[model samples]
Target: MVNTRTTDYWSQFIVDYSGGGDFFIANAYGKSAAQLSYDRVLFGSALQVVENIKLINNIIVVDLPVSAFQGLSLSPDDRAFYQVIADNQHLTGYEDLSSAFRPKKRIRRVDGPYEAEYFDGVYSAEKVRFIKLSRKLIEGELQVGVVVYLAQTLQSRNEMAHDISVKALQLVSVIFTIALSVCYVFIWFIVRPIRRLNTVLSERAPTDLTPIDTDAPKEISELLRTINHFMMQLQNTLDRLKHFTSETAHQVRTPLAGILAQSQNALMENDKPKRHSQITQVIDSCESLSRTVDQLLNQALLAHRFKSKALEKVWLGALIKEVSRDQVLTALQQKVELAYIGPNDDCQIVGDTVALKKMLQNIIENAIKYSPKQGVVEITLIIEKNREINDIRPRYGHS
Candidate 1:
């Protein structure tokens, strides 16, 4: 019965023996036959272990001092073989089966005392990793030792890794395709509302300024609201322009008709003084027509200013005085006295100057038109605390 300590010692001894064999092979390089012979003799005691194993029918029999070799207990597929050669000639070696062996590729030379190769075994017809240690011993003399291992586990691991890589690649491709499809759907939903808006605007008539009615996302809805506001403003401007055109035509027609009638009357009058009075009436009508035309033009200009011009600081008192001065000639022609009553201090307001001037002119002109002959048309600018008021009135003048 071999003890545990004895089994361990023999196991270590086997490992040391294998390593020593590689060392011996490498050191044997560049040695003549006589030198090799002499070295082997010197190492005869260490080499005796291998010879003794051979004498025991390649089996390690342990009773008290020896332990059975553990390799003999391994399955045939896991078993390893060892061999030795000298001068490219077989020296001493053994295999379970008779077969030819040749090294197919040099694998690597380990940093230790050994080299290794890989090959296929003709007897088993299987791939194997063959570890070797070799040396050139003098001219035409070489010696080597090799240990061969079956590569079944390595081949199985390689196949498994290839399968895993293929599966991972397939999973990645599937995920990318699904993500692309989702993005395409999302973009389509976003673009659909914009396309609808385009179609509605493109197909409408040029004169159409009606608000658009459509359902959309919140952002697009805000854009639609802005567009609708612009359209409403455009519609109001068009309506105002139409009304102004109609009013201008009516106003002009009245003055023209009056002038024509007065001229015809003057042509028929036999009295010179009466005919001269009729001619004066025609001239007054023409002047009134001219004033009306000017007012219409001013109104049009004010409309444009309202759209395009921003409010500015205006001197209200000065503007009122200027308007009154401009209307003095018209008031005199009508035999109406124009008077301005206001504080001398300048009053300021934020307003459009053109619009304010036109408004004041309209008030004064209307006052003078309605006043009787020898009437006074008074324009007063009253400055109160925190407010300013413009007043226009007509009063009868003393004869």
Candidate 2:
């Protein structure tokens, strides 16, 4: 059997067979009237010439079927035909979509994925398949707008899906950003107050039992309670330390003083050089022991005053003068010269008067002890003017 391709039946037969309208032909072959008629009806559409053109391949080509051209001249049917094609959401089968298909047959279903070219919009899953087939069966290549034509009725649906996706993404992004901001603020509120409390705890306050502003960020209430608990422990430790030092000093100082006095008296009574040397060594040992006890007592007193914050304000000048006066007699006994060089008038400083007196007396007594016979010990008090008054404890060092 001879295979005929692309029909070209005569006009008179085209008019008779096609209800007397326009015609189009498929390219490349001549066939008997009987054969073309069988081919056309079998193909499900009639073939007639709408345009007759010569092909470089030495073939005459006429495109589409007679019915298509017949409807093209009828303006009302033209739009309806296009509309029907667009609404006809039917797949052209997988065989047409397959890359290898190159059929000599031209009349096939123009409903598939290829219709995207006619309508440049997104398509429904069913509609997308229809346009895909249309391009393979009719236009012979996949086209951009062809898919659009098949799926155009479903354009609103595609747009709605797209908008929903974008809106959902935006909502997620906004929610995350809001959550992050809230978390940042929450943490800052918790940390800032706790940090302030930490600063206060580290500093040397006047007392062990002194109450601090316990208010803090509410988020970490447990952490604040822990710090308060630690503070209580610290106060207990300080109290124990102060009591121990005071008790130890009292216990050891009285006996040491008695021993020092007895040693001094024995040193004077001993006439033998060897005996005098032994007595002097004993006196030195007693003196050293007394000094150590005095130091411990003084430190314990200072700690106690710090705990109570009972350090009273006194005239620094009167304080200095009293220490100087006491030192004069000691200086005279030691055969050392004592002098003062500072402000003429009273200078006020906030501190415990007793502790201040003791401190000043200790310094002067030390000066008298260390200075050579007939040496001058100068005591100076410098007053700095400032709004906030503080105790200027003078530290003496030998250069």
Candidate 3:
């Protein structure tokens, strides 16, 4: 394709200069005269092309002898192009025109031309492809060559592709920025409720066992429910502890006060018998106080153990009889008859031993305290299918 274009351009150049080459051929005599004609016509044509064509730029016609370089009307642009060729003498792929004029290098009638590239001044050191044409002088052995060049800059060619690439990069950057913004918004929305919940909990007093309220995200609703459940359990535990503390203080204070009063009475009594009786009552009060403290401590320990204790098969009758022994002292003091009568065989049930003992101890102690003096307090263990305990305590005022 480049060969065809070069051939066509060479033909057009020959046509443009119709009579110029013939004029030189007619007046020529010796080799020097032919070289003179060569210099005159080639330089003339270059000047003509520069003047006539407004678009043509960056051209250099060389090998026309240094002597012939003088006496030519040159412009600033033309001088600059000539200087560029002179400076970079070894510019690839542009060779000196003198090489084509070598004496041994014969030019065949039907030989194809080749192309080369050189830096054009208008394009600032950028190589532009040019068509080189050489013709041997018929009258002499000297050869003349002309390099027809087209100057091209980096800024030219495929402007649309460059623009499209730039726009595509900008669009991708914008999309990436938008994606990051969306992720940040989503993360903040999800974490806002949890952060607020933490702040509320941290700011609250240690005694405050209130359940938390929040409009949490649906993804963490189950977590919120679990937290609320824990809070409710905590509140129940706190309430139980408060009730137990108050009851223990009240129960313990009564026995301690009885001991104090009995001791004072024993110290003041003049009769030895009365004083001895008062001393005995003080001793009894101390024993009752010690039992109450031990029971309260055991109840607290039992409450703590309820969560982790394993269930064991326990005989209900034996458990009842053992617990009844503790209350015998209270029953005797109250003048109430405490009797346990149940099945002699193994009445097995699955339960925690400590929990059941505490339960029975509480029931029998209440029964003996409430029963009338010398009244029968019968304790019976009934193993039923549905697993229920029916308490049949005697009426307070009954015979």
The best candidate in terms of lDDT? 1
TM-score of each: 0.48, 0.35, 0.42
lDDT of each: 0.61, 0.50, 0.56
Candidate number achieving the greatest TM-score relative to the actual structure:
1
Order of the predicted models by TM-score, top scorer first: 1, 3, 2
Where model 1 places Cα greater than 4 Å from the true spot, the runs are 1-185, 258-278, 328-341, 366-379, 388-399
How far off is model 3, as Cα RMSD? 21.5
Q: 77-121 in candidate 3: lDDT tens per residue?
A: 222123112222432322433232233333222223332223222
- Tens digits of per-residue lDDT for model 1, 176-214: 689999999999999999999999999999999999988
Candidate 2 residues 1-399, lDDT tens each?
533322213322332343311111211111123233322222222112211211324322334445634422332211111211122342222222222222343234432222121222223222321222222122333222111111113233333333343344445447768999999998887688878877877784658555466676566577777766777878887778878867886778776776777676676765687667757767777777777778777877876776676666688887787789877888889888887776686776678887778878887888788887778887777666773234334333332
lDDT of 1: 0.61
Higher-ranked by TM-score: 2 or 3: 3
For model 2, what is the alpha-carbon lDDT of residue 258?
68
Candidate 1 colliding pairs = none
Q: Is candidate 1 or candidate 3 better by TM-score?
A: 1
Screening candidate 3 with a backbone cut-off below 3 angstroms (N, C-alpha, C), the clashing residue pairs are none
